[model samples]
Structure formats: C-alpha cells, structure tokens
Target: MRLSTTQGLGDEPPETNAASSVRKKPDGAKKVNIGEWIDGRYIIEERIGAGGFGTVWKAVESKREEFVAVKEVRHKWLNSPKMLNYFKNEFKVLERLSHESTVCPIDLVRGNGTYLIIMEYLCGGSLSQRLRHSEPLEISTALLITVRMLDVLKACSRLKIIHRDIKPSNILFADKSFEQPKLGDFGLACFKSELLALSPRAIGSEIAGTLTYMSPEQLNGKKLSVKTDIYSLGMTLYKMLTGRLFFDPELLSRAGIKRAILRPFREHPGRYRPDLPYWLDELVMNMISVEPRKRPGDPQAVLDVIERNS
Candidate 1:
C-alpha cells in the first residue's frame, strides 16, 4: 500500500493478516502488535504506509512525546553485510543535505536484526494524490510546485547526489495548510560521484524505478547523470499541467518510450489540455527530450523559464 502524508493524524484501515503481522517492542522482543515499540524509545502508534522495500509507521518517542516517521527495513533483506553497510552509509549522505524543499532524514537506528530510519513527518499528501483528485492547478500554482521541486534538485546537485527516481509520487506536499511541495522518497537516491566510480559490471539487472517516470537513459540501462532527473521533472510538470499521462503506459516499453520522446510536441500538444500556452508546451517538450543533452542543463534554468512564464 502507498503511504501518503496528510494533515492531522488519523487511524488507517486495520490489517487483516493478524497471523503474519509481528510487532517489535522496546525490550527487543517480538509481539503480535509490532507497532508498540522498537529499541525501547519509539512507540509505534500505527502503520502509516508500506512499500516493496519496507513499511513506514507513525511513532512517538516514549520519553519525549515527539512524533516521527519510522521506516523499517526487514533484517533479512539487509543481512547481506555489504548491503547493510551501504544502507548505513546513505544516512551519512542524507545528513549532509539540508534544504527546505527536501524531506530530511532524522536518524538511523538498528535493533533485533531490523534497521529503522527516523524522519521528519510532513502533513500533506503526495503530488500524485493532488493531481489525481483535484482539477489542474492554475499556472501560478503549477509554477510554484515546479520551482520548489527545482530547489530540491538544486540542493541535491550541490551534494553530488542524484535522485534516480523523480516523479509526482515522490514529490510531497508539506501540509494541507502550507500548500508547499517537498521532495520525498530517497530510497533510490545515490551520490553521483560515488556511483560513477563503481564498476558497472557489479550492478544488477533489476530496474531501479517506476517505469512511466524513468528517463530513456534509465530504461536503456545506460549510465545516468543529473540530466536524468531533469528529464523526469520535465515529464512530471507535463503530466501535472496537462492532467494526463505524458505517454501511454500501455505503450511504455523501452523502444516505445524512446520513440515517444523523439516525436514532435505538436503531435500531442492539444491531446490533454487544448488551451495550454504554446510556450509552456515547448518548455515541457524540451525537458523530456530523449537525448539528455537536449534537455535543460539544470533545474535552476528550468525554474527560471517557468517563473518568467508564470
């Protein structure tokens, strides 16, 4: 199940698999309700969200009454000693990044063969949810979202980090009251400098991100750089403003995606939102160019163009 950040705390639907559900408590013992406590400090209030890699829970600090989001990655997956080390190392990388537009990771904890990542809890839903239920945002609102997202990309660039996966689902709203956007889901994030130095022969065949949002280079299993993320953000902007999938999911096989990217913008310009400005259409087309070099050089440049148009 997808985990969404919303304003205010509320209980979610109960899990039906009571037999398989296991809770880890403060004393490092396993219990039926695993959400009770972990490492003797965190009191798991409830399960907030779950994904393929792990589950995120809303937990309270038993002594401080502080609320935090805890992500639990199963020990079995991290048992590969090398994998565990890499996971811990990422926490250090996250700590170096500080930006208003990025959802920060607070700390990392380990207990009873489980690794838990503590993070600040935001109260707004994801950009994906916003786009799904609401009408297309005004140009000004869309620009605001884009600009904030750019800010996030800029910060990551400064740290030599690349968010391999960039999409609407990963861009989170801060809170219902704020209406500001923050970048989330750093699980696939990597330091460009580090990744580049590693031998490609060691990498596995497993694709690292959502299919629809992947850049052509990503789909081809080619080496990626910051430009890869720019292409994604460009596609995200197009989808958010147009209220339609930029490319047909049914036709999203690698070759089809490449061809779609190579096509002229004029062909699909009016398919989603007929009245959209021609300049905006051109901007998105350039952003999603199949050739990474053809896309915007950086997020700042994209934001500058968007702000001026808005």
Candidate 2:
C-alpha cells in the first residue's frame, strides 16, 4: 500500500512547480484532460498547477497503482529546436541524480507536442504554504529543515550542480508530519543558459527564484559557485524562522531591488526576532553577504557550523 501524509490541516494538494510548466501560446497550456490516460499507463486525475514555465497534473501510474506528478511543457517550446534540445539535456541531468531529500524523477515522455516529466508525489504541501498561513516556526524546527536542505545541497555540490532556485515554495514535505523536507524543482537549472536568455515569464518561476532571494553575484552575471545557492538558502531560513520576508521586492523598482540585493549586509535573523540565537545570526548573515567569497565556502562548511552551534 502507498503511504500518505495525514495533513490534519486539511488535504491541500502538495505543490511542485506549476510555473515551471510551459510558455503561453495560442493552443493553451496542455492537451490532456481529467480521466484521460496517457503513455498508456498513467491516468490523469486533476489539474494541480499552471505557471509560465509549465503545467502539472496529479496522476496515477496504473502499472504501479501509485500516485505521480506529471509536469508538462507546451509545444511552443518544442517549436524551438534549441529549447527542445535543452529540455532533453536537462531531463538527462535530472534523471541521473538520486537523492533522498530531493523529489525523484520517474519518467519522461513526449506527447503529440507537449513533453511530460513524471515524478513521485508528496502530500504534505510546500514550505511556502506553511509560511503563508502559520506564525513563525520554532527555531529548532527551522534549523532541522535547514540542515536537511543543506544535506541536499552537499550532494548536489559533489556533482558541481547548483540548485539555482532555493526558496520556501520549492521545498516539499514528504509527509504531513513536515519533517522530511525534500528539495523540489531539482536540476531545473541545467538549462541556466535558457533562463539567462529568456525573461522570468518565459523561463518560469521555479527554475530560478524570485528577485528577493537572488544573490548579488547572480544579478551581476558573475560565474556562479556553491555560494549562489547558499545566499538563497539563508533567505529561506530567515523566512522560516521569522515568518517574514527579508526584502519586499514589490516595494522597489527593478533597479532598486537589484541595488538592495547588491547592498552590503547589515541585518540578521535576530534583527526581526530578538530571541533568535547569536550563532544563527552569525551563520545566516554570513550566508547573505553581498560577496560570494564572504559566504560559506560550501554546504559542508555551513553544516559544520550547525553542528558546532547545536
């Protein structure tokens, strides 16, 4: 039997990257409908998410009698031979990585025009939802989640793969208990070139991250290193621990927002919630430093700090 999360909080569908689905087109998002069977094995159940990059549906793989998430890319992207190849390359990269704290890829399929990526389904909803509805999480709880995500980043770093996007929304709970936080939208940045070449709307929300979490180096178009993800990770932990956003991009114009991210670091987690620990303030603020060299050298370095502080 398949295990499921008991979300006592109501059975809200856990979300992946709906915005990572597809580009807009005259034909619309996708051609599938509820109750339809595709690939001759997986049966579509319902529309779960839709974004600038792609669309996602809840489905059941008849062969395994198990639930799965089907991600779709529209034909508009396929029409571009360049994008089509990039999609294929990205799939290959995602297919190779096997990490427990990351959403696992199942299969990739090519439809009449759309392409579909099948992945394991989770039920506990996303960290973004938790942040949106609940008060600040306990410091211990926030640390636990951060440590697990650091574990994921350590594994990714081994392969020199940078998770360009690290935000509350891309973090998934394996169950309603909310303990197992697996990174979602993995390997979506294998096509960072595509993202840099396209606008946020065209590349989708999940591949990169919102302007608020971006590192100063990323904005400046400097070559990225592990520190890029660390900057966003710091931002995510700040939100979790304080139940607040670090910077409100909406309040600033495009250039203003860029300048804010580029500004020297002057605040820490404790600034918002005085009860936060000194160790936490030191670790997080270091990660959020404007210069990549000022951040932790790697996920392992940050993990070591957590161990020492804890």
Candidate 3:
C-alpha cells in the first residue's frame, strides 16, 4: 500500500523515455472493491488509500472490537512469480520488525487467491493528506516528525532492513493530534541478508519506488544498501521543509530523471523556507547525494546532524 502522493500516474508529466512510457500502461492488478470482506475476518469498511501496487482498507476484525488496516496486493500480481516474491518479502520483513515508529504486521491471512496483511490502525491520516489540506508545517514541527522517522530508520539499519519507499503518504500519525508519525508499508523493503544470499546475481531487476522520492540506485536497479533508504528519506524531508516536490515532475526524459536523481538540486531547501538553518540545507543535500557513499553512514548519523544543527 503505497500512500505516497507521487504514486499517481495522473500527476506524471508527459513521458519521452520509452522506459517511463511503459509506466503508463495498465498494471492489470485487481482492485479490491469497497464493502468487500476477506476470509470472513476483516470486513472492509472503506479504502483509505491506494497506489500502483496495492490498496489499503480500513477494516473491522470479526470477534474483535478494534479497527485495523488491511493491506492486500493486487490479485493479478499475486499470480505473477516476480511480483509474488516481493509481496511475500513484505510479510517476511514485517514479521521480523517491531518498532514504535515503524508499523509492524499483526497477522497475515490468505484466501481467494490473494494475501491480506492486518496492522494496527492509525487514524490521524497520512502526512500527505495533512500537507495537502493545511499550510506548510512549521519548521520545528516538520523536524520533530522527521526525527521520529530517523529513529525508525536507525532501528531498520540495526536490523539490516532497508525501506525502499519513503514519502509523505507512507508516514502516518498515530492519533488525532498528529504528534506521533510512524513509518508504514514494508512492501519494498530489502534485508541485507537476503541480498547477501543472492550474492553477485544482483537482486531482481524490477524497478521499485515512487518517482520523485526514488533514489538513483533504486531507479537504476543497482545493488542497494541502507544508503538507498537514506536517499529516499532525504527526499521526504525535502517535502516536509518545502511542502513541494524537490524536482519538476513535468520532465520525464532520461536526462530529466537522471538529473533529478543523480544531480544535486540547483535550488536549496532554505530557498523554500527561509527560517530553516543553513546547516539543514547541507544536511538534506547530503542525504540526497548522487552517490550512496556521500550520504550519512546511518540513520543515527542523520539524527546527529539534525541535532547539531537544531
């Protein structure tokens, strides 16, 4: 369930590159209709969000009086071998992770040839929704939310789980007050151990991630590491600071995409929000650096950089 605002193809600009052109084609993933029930356990209430890959439903659990978020991959993709692997990978990764700032899967149920994952429901909505309705968040407030996410990434680093997708919509508030933001959606996560097992074969070459926030390595389908997630988080931070996309989505050429991913931005974050510290501009720039080695060593380092500047 990729809730990131960038996931929509309607927002994608005219595509010149043949590679990106294919993105416009129908994915053939079956859509879960509203009011549907799965395995006689989760009664789908409403579709809270959706993306190119899956749809998320706010559901009620039978025999239990609590609300839960059930994420199900598209039925068509479930039948595809490669897509099936990634879907199962999410379940495997989520089961191993337990963190307050990271949403972990509570249960996995399969019926009718589709997989459903149940998770604790967070009602405050996504950061993307908040950013869409309200004015740009105060710098302090954005930083506070970012710091919490950094803590989650720090934990992921320790566990060798790299969350390839990090964008505004994937960040959810734990309650109505919008104080606690937990990172959700592990569908694109890659464990270092799994990569090691594949060794020199190079983990499957399916390009994953939303366009704007996707890192260079992710775009190229190169060998990835923790730094891949750092690059994405950096882009998410860019949105938190500016309340806008870091790049112009209008250009879809290879050069345009490469420039956006591999080249440093000609504009600075401070240009959007003057109140931000000068160090922050550099910190964010480093996070989105073209080279993985140039980014922070780990999420802890990112936290330290923010601390020193704050």
Candidate 4:
C-alpha cells in the first residue's frame, strides 16, 4: 500500500503503524530464515523490495520499536573470498555518505555467512513503479522528482562518490510523511579518485549496470566520471516524459544495439512526444549526447538548467 502525501506528515496510520510493529518474513533470499533477528536488534519483517544484488525488508528494532529497512546481501554470493572483500569494501564506501535525500546506512551486521545493512525504512514504493503504472506525471511533478534526485547526486559528488547507476528503479519515494524521495542502492557506486587511479586489474572489468540506461562511455568500458550519471538521468527524464525509451525498435538485435547508441536524439524525440518544450528537449539531448563531455558538467548544473526553465 502506498501512502499519499496529502494525508499530512508525522501521523502514522493505525493499520500501517500497527503492522510496522509486527515482525514478519523478510523478502528475497530463500535458503535462510530472513525473519530472524540480526544482532538482536533489527527484527526482520516482510520483504519490501528487491534488486539484482539483494533484497530490502521492512524491519523493526525490537528494543526501541523503531522501524528500518534491512538490505541483505546473499550469503552464497558473498561466500566467495574475493567477492566478500568487495562487499565489505562497498560497505565502507557507503559509510562515508551522509545525506537526507540519499538512503544512509544505520548499522551493519555480519551473520553466520551473510551480511546485512540496516537503513531508514521508507513507506512509499519505488519511482520506477510510479512511472510505469501511473499516468504520465505532470511536468511539474516530474521536475520535482528530478530536483530531489539531483539533491542526492550533489551530496554524493561532494564526497567524490560516483553513482554509476542512476535510474528510476534505484530511487525510492517515501510516503507523504517523509514526503521527499530518497536515492537507494549504492552497490555499484565508486569513488572518483579510486576509479581514476585504477589499473586494469583493479578495475576487475565487467559490464556492471542495466544496458538500457547505460552511457556510451560505460558501454565502451571506459572509466566513468560524474557526467556518466548525468547522461543516465537525462535518459530517465526522457523516458518519464514520453513513456517510452529513446532507442530504436530494431536495436534489440545484436548489431542494432550498437547502431542505436550512435543514433541522434533528433531522430527519436519527434516520434515519442512532439509537444515537449523545446528547452527541455534540448536539455535531454545534451544529456544523452554520444560524448560524455558534452553532457552537463554535473548533476547540479542539470538541476539548475531545469529550474531556470521552470
């Protein structure tokens, strides 16, 4: 159930408030009992969300009756000695991030063989669901979402963290109580200096994110910077506005995907939504430009441009 912002903030409804107090089964991993309490604090509740790497659960702190989100990294995947180290390293990176719009880790727990991260429990579902099922949101609503997300990216940039993946699915919307959107899932996030200084071995090469939202430089396996994320955000905004992707229909084939990446934005915009404002269209075009350098210098600059147009 999604909470509406119109209900006003700070009042937890009786139903959800009651359920929030009850512990239930956690979502995702099958081999273990996810509802089991970790470190005798967070009591695993029902599964709330999932992603490629792990599942997120609504959990309650038994001692304080406080609610939180628990992200569990699958034990099987983490058992690999190398992967375990990488998982631990990622946690360290997350610890360095502190932002209201970005989901922050509250606690870390290491179980028999798995690792769990405790985070703030957001009542609303993901932005991806809102975009996919709901009617096309008003341009103002879309801009509000974009501005909040940019706030998150700006905070991450201050700490030199580059969120390689920045799509609708990774952004969670809080119910009216929290009111603001929160950016989640930092598993693929990398430090700017570390990414720049990496040797081939250190990079541990692989295509790491969703292909539909990938930046051209990312597709080519080049080292990424903040601009790569800007490109993705631009694509996301385009999809949100038009309710369609910016790719060619023929691009699903092996040869076509490469060709579509090189396709110009002008050839595609008219096909989706011709009525989009010229300035907004131009901003998106600049964002998904084939050259990363051609994209906005930073997420803040993108937000500034949108706000100026607003």
Predicted structure with the largest TM-score when compared to the true one:
2
TM-score order, best first, reads 2, 3, 4, 1
lDDT for model 4, please: 0.66
Candidate 1, residues 1-310: lDDT per residue as tens digits? 1122222222232322211122322233122134566556667787777653456788887788888787765333343444445556546656777677887787677544456777877768788888886367666677778888788889888888888778888887768842678887676678886665232223322215665777777766678888888888877887788776566767578567556655544244446777888878888878888888888898888888877777
Give the Å error, residue 191, model 4. Answer: 0.4
Best lDDT goes to which candidate? 2
Error of 2 at 206 (Å): 8.6
Angstrom error of the Cα, residue 248, model 2: value is: 2.1
237 in model 3: Cα distance from truth in Å? 0.8
Q: Indicate whether candidate 1 or candidate 2 has the larger TM-score.
A: 2
lDDT per residue (tens digit) for residues 88-134 in model 2: 55456566557888888877776444567778888888898888864
Q: List the residue pairs that clash in candidate 4.
A: none
Give, for candidate 3, the lowest lDDT window spanning 10 residues: 3-12
For candidate 2, the C-alpha RMSD (Å) to the true structure equals 7.1
- Rank order (by lDDT, best first): 2, 3, 1, 4
Candidate closer to the true structure by TM-score (higher is better), 1 or 3? 3
Model 1 poorest 10 in a row by lDDT: 1-10
For all the candidates, what are their Cα RMSDs to the real structure? 7.2, 7.1, 7.3, 10.2
TM-score of 4: 0.79
